[model samples]
Target chain A: MDTKTLCDGILDGQRRALSKAITLVESARADHRVQAAALLEALKAAQASPREALRIGLSGTPGVGKSTFIESFGMALVREGLKVAVLAVDPSSARSGGSILGDKTRMELLSREAGAFIRPSPSQTELGGVARRTREAVALCEAAGFDVVLIETVGVGQSETVVSEMSDLFVLLLAPAGGDELQGVKRGIMEMADLILVNKADGDLKAAANRTRADYAAALRLLRKRPQDPDGFPKALAISALQEDGLAQAWAEMGTLADWRRAQGHWARTRANQNRHWFMEELRLALLAQLTQAGPVRDAVARLGDSVASGTTTPALAVQSALALLHP
Target chain B: MDTKTLCDGILDGQRRALSKAITLVESARADHRVQAAALLEALKAAQASPREALRIGLSGTPGVGKSTFIESFGMALVREGLKVAVLAVDPSSARSGGSILGDKTRMELLSREAGAFIRPSPSQTELGGVARRTREAVALCEAAGFDVVLIETVGVGQSETVVSEMSDLFVLLLAPAGGDELQGVKRGIMEMADLILVNKADGDLKAAANRTRADYAAALRLLRKRPQDPDGFPKALAISALQEDGLAQAWAEMGTLADWRRAQGHWARTRANQNRHWFMEELRLALLAQLTQAGPVRDAVARLGDSVASGTTTPALAVQSALALLHP
Candidate 1:
């Protein structure tokens, strides 16, 4: 299909067009990128008034019940007659052969919902590439009239932070555990989180979940409060995705926070900042890509790199020589 | 001075020549950079055998007694017939008018010592420029026959991690406080630390210092152990800069860690990796600088950035337009 048809289908809320557009954005081929750009531009022009989805970024370590929580929470939104879209950004998928979200039955009920759209993480080798594609996928979902876009990333090296950049709200999901497991979470991630949800608050884990919640509550208090949030935000709460308990309350809290941010004008300001940030980031990546692609400059970099590594030349001197090769 | 005279003076451990050479490297002028490169190359060729100083990176927030600790530590080393050099990398100095180490009497005794050399943070506007200048100054110190080069940076923002990149070992200094102050410490910095020193362990605060040390010790245990270290490494200890207590022990511990790394060949491997990392970093900075320096491209970036922020264009499409301006 052409760009116009894709834009029309997307504006009409057709799931098939959204998927096709995402594939186009994720494609590494030069031709596909041109088409993807055109399709996105066409969609932007076709919309009468810009529609936005509440982009929520969720992250948790493996076995932390992330998928279960997402499915439970997504169903709650769907029950309220809202359209939801889920996009995963898994940099590790390239190495693991796309093991994360690879199984189709992982979110069986949510997948069956007509109001819900689920897309697996793109199998991109670099985290930057994966994040860029996922960000575009989010834009496509919003253009397709989704009420909410849930971006999930494994709570591993750097991916969660990347996701947080593109998201309005960053929710960190944790298991019901004490300080040992808490220490495993990077402090940087904790600082970035807008909310911490301690899952497994049912059966034998109820007390443990409560305790974990209190611990995180105290920990969050110790962090310097961000000026953008209202009082008592970046707090922790307990939820049970298994029994579907506390799901409504968590959803309500998220709504409250989102509404407050929107009213306080933080939502618009933050989105604008994010857009500018991504534009600069993409420009930097493209320029660096040119350096690596040029055969002569690439070879010169490698040769000078070896000399620097072996201590035959200083880094500054090596860089000087490399730049000379580029320009001269 | 010419490159030959500077090389001879550096090899002879002349403090004036070392300072001049650092000024050369730190200069942003095109002519100065050429001369600096020539001077560095000459020094590299003059040395009969490469003599390296044990580089230690120290970081602590303001009011953490960093200068006091450095003074005491440097005095101790000087008394032991070892030449010591101290260099500060304070990126904040650019805005603060070099307030961090602006006072000439900050390390009065050490500054007066014949065996100790001290350099304040470079007054560069950007962190990358400041770090690059500091790294080259470190080379000058090593060439001037210093036995130990102490690199100090304020424990705020990304400066500490940048210091860790150039040093053989990274030490985090903390005040005698509890969880509140600990929370202020970024977890990323904690992971990078090879040693944690709780300072002001004297008078009324001795017990508090010890307790803080224990807390950090436990926290360090929770972090995954690094393979490069021997057992019981990256540990915390209490020290008193006022009374000069524990300075010898801290020095001994640093020696032990450094010796272990050298024995395991990690020292050489790490330095090689650092060299290559800096080379690539400088190259990236240079390429990005070109984008900002070109008048047409810079203006286009600003115009496109405004469009992106105003939601008039998607970031990817804006980037595409910017790239076309560059290549076309």
Candidate 2:
């Protein structure tokens, strides 16, 4: 099928385009980029038909079996007849400016499941594995009638909090370890996770996991509750992702939090804030692309850069001069 | 003094006015922001002056003796007649939007020193404890003839990298303990630091500290070196903030990094990049504030939020709709 028809099929919720479209959108070939943008715009319009769908963000350190857990959790929801869409985020090449697309391997089960559509998207050198295309991919998913869209960011991307701006519920997965686990995360991360799950709680580690949970719970009490998670209740939980134990219970807990938020009308306000944030991010990125990629200022930027390095011009002077040339 | 005169004094290298100007800039008074902007504009025009100063950013985890070490370090620099200026980045108040300004108390000795100028500026609800106004404070310090400027951020703020963005050198202080320390900090952060100082390394923990230094040195081999610390070297040292052992050496190492970076032309490049980044950040933030704080669209944004929470409208749709209202 042609690009237009592919996009139409995607809009009509045809499962094939849902898979193919992600690949196309993630492609870097010049023609593919053009087609991807067209498809992405169509997907955006389709999702925009009534309103947008809920975008959920999932993140944790790598090797925590994020894929297996996602598969199980997603399958469970699919069995309940909900159209679950998973947009798995992965790291990219800094020099080549492309993605390895390695997540599809880990998410083999979910990728093969019919009711659960999983798209492992590459981050492509963006700050967070969650990229501009990732946001667009999410639009395509919702337009395709998927109810739940999960975005998984790269494990090592610390400064990439941009997902918070895209997601409705931010769920963090943690490997249940000892008290030392707390030291792994920065306080900023601890403050961001709406629900913290201690994954891999199956064997002899179960007791250690529980102790870790208790320690985190105690440590959490010292932190003022995030106003965003204002249920006035602790939101941390322990689950064995491998055993799939507590998976259903965790989903139910997520529902409860969603209900509490809606009843309190905080969800709307939160999304509104998130939208404003995305708009700014888009502008920042677009401007950066334009400024960095422009033909006219590139040489000047490079030259001024050399002068600044040589101390022939100070930073303030260099910037003043560079922007002047770019803007002029 | 009148705001204009106060700003002039700063530009004229009057020490008193620089402090007064920083206080005025940090004030959220109705007129203070406008006054600060004016002062900044005036200072910007006086760009011809090049003061021999090094901007150093110091960060580490909480209990890493960040405050205590800064006190000892700042005092040492001043004793050398360097005319040190420290802008202690305080954590922002998430709710009240007030500043705690605790740096002075934490650095009682340094604050009371004859030639040392220590200013505890509130971060005011930023992800990093470094306040938006901290840059202004730095500029004011430069204008006031301070030869060395130190910016201190709370380790818990998770914005060590943000503070790292503004300075000539990034000094990451780590406490000596915890077998998990290497794994705790991802390669991204370790790669960003120019120098890693193991604090509280005096006496009992010296051996453990040495092990950590060895482990980190081994680990850093896998990553690209920060240009300022060539030989792919991340200077590792042990210091007891309490005893102030190795304090002078730490300062000397920092000075060496600055000199080397300056020689490599990296110092100017770094500052120029920081300036360009500020411009980019300002452009994005200005637009964000304008959109969210707009009068008509604010309520419409609040209204469209409902469809998003009920899962009736996806976040992307709500955003597009909000933008329609905002732009229309």
Best by DockQ: 1
Candidate 2 ranges beyond 4 A from true positions: A1-8, A16-86, A91-116, A122-328, B1-4, B27-38, B44-48, B60-80, B92-101, B127-131, B171-226, B230-264, B294-328
True contacts kept of each: 0.72, 0.04
Cα lDDT of model 1 by residue, A145-263, tens digit: 99999999888899988999999999999999984466467888989898899999999999999999998888788865997778898879999999998888888878889999999
For each candidate, what TM-score against the reference? 0.71, 0.66
TM-score of candidate 2 chain A against the true chain A? 0.81
The residue-by-residue lDDT of candidate 1 on B1-328, one tens digit each, is 8888888999999999998999999997767877887877777887878879999999988888999999999999999999999998888887888554553488899999999999887887699888888988998889899999999998889998789999999999999998446647788998999999999999999999999999888878887599777889988999999899999999999999999999999999999998888889888887687567747778999899999998999887898998788766
lDDT of each: 0.87, 0.67
Per TM-score, the best of the predicted structures is 1
